[model samples]
Target: MYGFIWRHLPGNPWVKALISVVLVLAAVYVLFQYVFPWAEPLLPFNDVTVNDQ
Candidate 1:
């Protein structure tokens, strides 16, 4: 899959590397800014409890 993307990206190695970094950053930004926030409330990570036995 990654090989397919690398082949489709325009320009030589340097340009391709730059574009790859940018695409990764954009994906991370979207996940953190939108996806994670939307899914957070649905997850059980915050449902913590402690017993003093």
Candidate 2:
């Protein structure tokens, strides 16, 4: 998958690297701004409990 993206990106290696970094940052921003917030309530990570016995 990464190979596919790397192949499709235009320009020399340095340009490709810069675009890759931008794409990654954009993806991370989207996830934190939208995806994670939407999914957080459905996930079980916060439903913590302890057995006192």
Candidate 3:
């Protein structure tokens, strides 16, 4: 899959590296800004407790 993406990126090594970095940052930004927030309420992270019951 990575090889496929690398082949499709239209540039030499330096340009390809730059594009890959930008794409990764964009993905991270979108996930943190939208996806995680939307999913947070549906997850059980806040329900965790350390009780000796």
Candidate 4:
């Protein structure tokens, strides 16, 4: 799969690197901006809050 993807991408190393980075950023943007915000409220995590009451 990695070989196929690399082969389809740009031949130049610099151009391939740029495309890889852009692809990653695009995925992250879609995940964090669209999915994570909605999923975070539904999923639970430990909240550590220190309060002097």
> What is the C-alpha lDDT profile of model 1 across 10-50, one tens digit per residue?
99999999999999999999999999999999999978999
TM-score to true structure, per model: 0.90, 0.86, 0.89, 0.67
lDDT values of the candidates?
Answer: 0.99, 0.98, 0.96, 0.86
Q: Give the runs in model 2 whose Cα sits over 4 Å from its true position.
A: none
Model 2, span 1-53: residue lDDT tens: 99999999999999999999999999999999999999999999979999999
User: Which order, best to worst by lDDT?
Assistant: 1, 2, 3, 4
> 1-53 in candidate 4: lDDT tens per residue?
86787789976988988898898999999999999989897875756587999
Give the top-scoring candidate (TM-score): 1
**Predicted structure 2, TM vs. truth:** 0.86
After aligning candidate 3 to the native by TM-score, how far in Å is the CA of 51 from where it should be?
Answer: 3.1
Candidate 1 regions with alpha-carbon error over 4 angstroms? none
| Highest lDDT scorer | 1
Identify the runs in model 3 with alpha carbons over 4 angstroms from their true place. Answer: none
Angstrom error of the Cα, residue 44, model 4: value is 1.7
Please give the distance, in angstroms, between residue 10's alpha carbon in candidate 1 and its true position after superposition.
0.4
Residue range 1-53, candidate 3, lDDT tens digits? 99999999988999999999999999999999999999999999999879897
Clashing pairs in 2: none
Instruction: Order the candidate numbers by TM-score, best to worst.
Output: 1, 3, 2, 4
